[model samples]
Target: MLASFDIGALGHSFWALTISGLTYGSIYALVAVGYTLVYGVLRLINFAHSEIFMLGMFGQYAALMMFGFAPQGDAYDMGVAQTLMYLGLAMIGGMVVSGAAAVGLERVAYRPLRRRGAPALVFLITAIGASFVLQEFVHFVLPKLTNNTLGGLNAQQPIRLVSPSTQFTIFGATVTNVDIAIVVSALALAFATDRFINGTKFGRGIRSVAQDPVTATLMGVSRERVIMLTFLIGGVLAGAAALLYTLRVPNGIIYNGGFILGIKAFCAAVLGGIGNLRGALLGGLLLGVMEMYGQTVFGNEWRDVVAFVVLVLVLMFRPTGILGESLGRARA
Candidate 1:
């Protein structure tokens, strides 16, 4: 047990928790970058992002359930190539499903009200309410589709992905197949997003519209398309993050787990400066590293306090966040 406080304990804690913090921070930064992107262009919090993450988890789980229910449920049926194919399919499917859900929510729930000239307050509440509605909708639909009273499948079952006897040592740490998969997948996403945003017409449009909606409109940039695409891309990223999170936790997906992580990502966005893409990455990494060590030193009970403390300090020193962009600033 940790004795309230000990100055001499700090050094030991720092050494032990350094690696832990970096790993956790990388994930945090990746997720926060999603929030920064959506908010940078739209200026709306997208309160439902956490729920979108939750949706991704459910979607992936549903896909996995379907696979398990098939006759080839046994791992034996999958050769090396086939296993890779299934993973790719599952992740892509989950992301697509989540992106579609976000798009649908924006169109059906948020767009109509915005079109009617609703107050920002009304918009904010609507966003929050929309999150609840989505959560309820998922809960309502899952049981009907799966017919498994206890959340469709047994998530507690030990996950045996690559092989039973597959483990490697890296820097005195055991690296499992799952870890390799997560690192590779996250890197792939990072690379893809970099290319898509900087090398594509759609990305050009997104930036143009973000800079000046009226001018972008005059230049033939469709605000609607940009907004829609933003939501879609954000949804996809959140979906991918959800998959990574589950692999890390391994205890199965909880319906509301997204809220906390969502908030953390949002904080990360704010830390890096909301509109700055690279800043989100940096802030998330810093936050994750700080949080890891804080928990190690102070125990799990103060993890949140540590996160908030970092936020407060960052805000105090750099109110515009690490990227020097203010998330709360008015756009349009």
Candidate 2:
């Protein structure tokens, strides 16, 4: 059996791994927020959410193709202005597609069940079923629909709009333009979401529903509307995360691309406090850094195992997470 740990390599790559981990964690943070928000209000796992993120990936790719980008063997090099435009457009495309898909999912998959007073286990099964349905639809139906132009159970070609060239060194670790963009954009979006959940009237309504749906309904908060909004917010954030994720893994936008990352994002949400927005952000960043450290210490093959182990340990010790609180306690 291979030795379980290797400390020497870790010490050598500490700074580089730290920087890269932060970049990866930022993407997780964005996706985690979606999981956190929907859970906060609905108290549902929304397993099909991974599919929403996957749709965002396809959405942005479709947008890029519409903008005249084509697959090539080598990465595309573009000016900063052009790159920024493409990035903005792709993110927007992703956000729109994901947000719409989420709403449709609510309207179609969960709404009827909710109206019929379905049990939690039933909802869980429905979510999983919806997830597979979306995946299969993309893998099988999309190819025929597009005349084999879009989908076919294969990894999509790389979208190389932005080159990940090193822009500067931070604490002896190289930071690329993509890294800066991912972190800054994710932080900005996270902050905005935090404010939306904790400071606004709508935010108050969401918290009220989370705390006591019947009371909120009696107070004139539309429960149905809140649920729809929650899904929309989660989907939009997932879509943003999808673009950032593609930036990190240029060729990773496959039909099942979101499954593993989505699970990690959910783990981040749970690690931080399942129903807490800021907690999800904290959990994501921590998980990313820890995963990198684990990879360095135990080799790349153990990267994911390390993350899951951390999750199990965290749950065993501090089940409420680092910033333990539900959405109701967010502003409290």
lDDT at 253 for candidate 1? 63
CA lDDT of each candidate?
0.70, 0.89
* TM per prediction: 0.85, 0.97
Q: Candidate 2: where is the Cα deviation over 4 Å?
A: 1-4, 330-332
Model 1 lDDT-worst window of ten: 150-159
lDDT of 1: 0.70
Task: Encode model 2's per-residue lDDT on 1-332: one tens digit a residue.
Answer: 44567898888778899988998898888898888888888889999999999999988988888899996646788887988899899999999999999999999999999999999999889999999999998899988998776767788878788778899996778999889889999999999988888888988988899888998999999999999999999999999999998888888888898888889998899999898888999999999999999988887888888899999999998988878867876353
